[model samples]
Structure formats: structure tokens, C-alpha cells
Target: MPDRVLVAYGTKNGSTAQIAEAVAEVLRKDGLDAEALPAGSVTAVEPYDAVVVGGGLYAGRWHKDARRFVRRHRRSLAGRPLWFFSSGPLDASASERDIPPVPGVRRAMTELDVIGHATFGGRLEEGAKGRMARMIVRSGRGGDFRDFTAVQAWADRVGQELTAAGRR
Candidate 1:
């Protein structure tokens, strides 16, 4: 059977979830069994051969669900190939250059020995949750800055790595 991979994410306005789904789709196209799910909804990672976790950024921190998910599954995650991603930059910077993971995510990467990470631009539009979100949209600063091309390229690289590793 092909290796099973889990792409999980946490998001407030549903942008990060879209990124996770895209990653999972690429992995599936690459001949792996992959699924994207919400971080909070996942109870365990023991069944998957590899995992990808992602979260939306708010106030320089990952969403609480993502943080808690990592803490809760650290042991199992340590034993598997793991990757992380953050989606929260509200501009073109992510597509223009590589954005390093935030301090919190960096610490988790070190602790869990994650294989890779990427930062993608975020999306905020009308009907986004929370007062601050609404305020940002009203102020004309909210827009979708996510680059799906970059997202696909990253997932393709990840799929290559996983496929190569499985062969060995």
C-alpha cells in the first residue's frame, strides 16, 4: 500500500485549511494516500506514515488548536517524517521570498526534528470571523495573498522526499 500521510491544519477564516487541502491533493496525485483534516479534529497520528501540520498566524503565534495538537502528539510525531507550514502574511512577501517559520513553530521544529516548513500568504475577506478581521477588511487591508503555485511546488518537493524515503 502507498504510504498514508496526514495534512492537518488550524485556521480561523478557513485559509490555512485550503492550503492544507492543496498539499494533500498534490501528495495524492504523486501516488500517496493523503488526507487533509483540521488539527483539532484529529485524535491521533499513529496511523499515518507521514504528517504535515499547519496553522494560521495571529499575533505572532500559531492558532491555539495547532499548538495543542503538536503538544499532544509530539511523541508519535517524533517517530515519523513530519512537516509544518504557516499561512498568515497578508502580502506578496511569501511568494517573493522564503519566510522562515515563526519563533514558536521554529521551537517545535527543533523539538520534533521536522523535515521542512513553508510560509504562505494568507486570505482575509468579507465574512471573516472576529472583530479584528472585520475591521481589517473594512480598512481595505484584507485580501487573499495566497499563491497556489508556490504551494503546489512545495508540496511536490515534499512528495518527492516522501516517495524517495519510502523506496529506501
Candidate 2:
């Protein structure tokens, strides 16, 4: 199998895009051909060897783009190695960020038979959100809780596993 991977993300404030990029970079470093793309902009996943779909966890749901992407590509995804991630938990604990998947994401995961799923800490800065969003952030521990090291580690592990599986 070829080592091309797609890292697709649905991000409202671009933080998830940044995380996708980081995941791609780490995969590339591990010798996988990987590119990060916006879920809404992607019309097809057929070209990739594997896919990693991600989005922000907002209002107990994934961002619309990610959900829509899964809905559109459900059949194609079911035949391949797929991974899912959810970002955006203002809490300091990355462990605490492991919230359950929203209904849409859970459906996708169930249908696709995903290899794995992860939840990363989110970023919520002042002025980065709307009035209500900002207020919500203000009411919590507002900070950049993204853990890049863990992100890279996860990508590396995934890349290695992908390569190993390809050899089988």
C-alpha cells in the first residue's frame, strides 16, 4: 500500500487546521506522504491511502464540515483505514479532554470501523470567539491547551502502524 495520508479537519477558528497541519508534519517526518486539508474543501478521499478526520468539539457536536465530509464519503471511508479526532476542550487536562463522540461522529466511527480515535486539548483565547463564545471561555480556564508533543507522538505511532500494516 502507498503511504499517502489525508489529514482533514473542520475548524471554525482555524485551531483544528493548525492541529491537522502538525499531524501531517509529524507523519511526513515518519516518511508518510501526508497533507492537511479542510474537510469542506475536500471533495474526495479516494486518492489517499488512509484518512484522519478531525474537528472541533462544539456544543456537543463536531464542526459541520467534518460531519458533512463523513456523510458524503461514508462508503469510501468504510473500505479503508480511518481515524478520528476531536479537538477543543478548554480544560487543562488532556486526559479530561477525552469526551465521547457526538452523535454524527459516533455514527461515522461505527460505519467506518475506525482504527482509532483521539481527543486533544483545545485553545480558547480572548477575542478568538464571538460574544457568547468569549463569555463561555471567560467562565473557564482560558488558555492554549494543545499538547504538540503528544500530537506528534500520536502521528508518529499512526504512521509507523500504517507502514507496518502496509507490509502485511
Candidate 3:
């Protein structure tokens, strides 16, 4: 049987959710059974052989929902092959270089024994919620910085790793 992988994400303006979906798509194309869903909606992680959790970065921290999900599913997640991703750079920095996880995410990785992590660019376009988001958009600083090509590449690696492990 193919490995069942869950790609769960915490997103505010929905860009991170899109990223998660793309990741899941790549996994499926690579022959794994993968699905993407909001982190909060997931009631259990025990049914999956692996998990990928992602969140939008906010003020040097992960989205609250992502943090809570990790805390809630820590035990089950710790035993599985896990990966994490954060998207929240409104600039080209992420595409140009490696951006380490924020302090909290780094700590979570240690506690969970996560297999890998990636930081992708973020999106903050017009109509985004929050006063700060609005202001940024008005200031002309809001736009999509996510690189779908990079997202696909990373997911392919994840799929390859998982598929190889499963064959053992």
C-alpha cells in the first residue's frame, strides 16, 4: 500500500494553504496518497504514515493555529516522519537564500524530530485582513513572493525520501 501523508497548514490569507495543496499534489504525482487540510480541522494524525505541517510566519512566530496544532498533536507527530515549512517573507530573500525557522519553530523541530524544513516567500495582497496588512498593501509592499517552482521541487524531494523509506 502507498504511504498516507497529511499536509496540514495554518493560513490566514490562504496563500499558505495554496502552498500546502501544491505540496500534496506533488506527493500524489510521486505515488503517495496525500491530502492537504487545515491544521485545526485535523482530529488525528495516527492514520497517516507521515505529516507535513506548515504555517504563515507572523511577527517572528508561527500562526497561532499552527502552534496549537503542534502542541495538540505532539505525541503522535513525534513518532512519525515529519516536515515543517514557514511562509512569510514578502521579499526575494527566501528564494535567494535559506531562511531558518523562527525560534519557536526551531524548538518545535527539536522536540518533534522533524525530518526537514523550508521557508518560502509569502503573499500579502490587497483585501488581506488586519490593519497592518491593509497598510502594507497601501504602502505597496504587499504582493506574492511565493515561488511555486521551489515549492514543487521541495515536495518532490519529500516524496522521493518517503517513497524510498517505504520501500525498505
Candidate 1's TM-score: 0.98
lDDT-better candidate, 1 vs 2: 1
Error of 1 at 138 (Å): 0.8
Model 1 residue 116 CA deviation (Å) reads 0.5
Candidate 1 Cα errors over 4 Å, as ranges: none
146 in model 3: Cα distance from truth in Å?
0.4
lDDT of 1: 0.95
* For model 2, the run of ten residues with the poorest summed lDDT: 92-101
* Clash-forming residue pairs, model 2: none
Clash count per candidate: 0, 0, 0
Cα lDDT tens digits for candidate 3, 1-168: 338999999999999999999999999999999999999999999999999999999889998889999999999999999999999999999999999999999999999999999999999999998898899999999999999999999999999999999788
TM-score of each: 0.98, 0.92, 0.98
Model 2, 1-168: lDDT tens digits are: 558899999998888999999999998988889999999999898999899999998887898999898889988888888999888888756654456776778877887899888788888887775675788767866678898877888888888889888789
Stretches off by above 4 angstroms in model 3 are: none
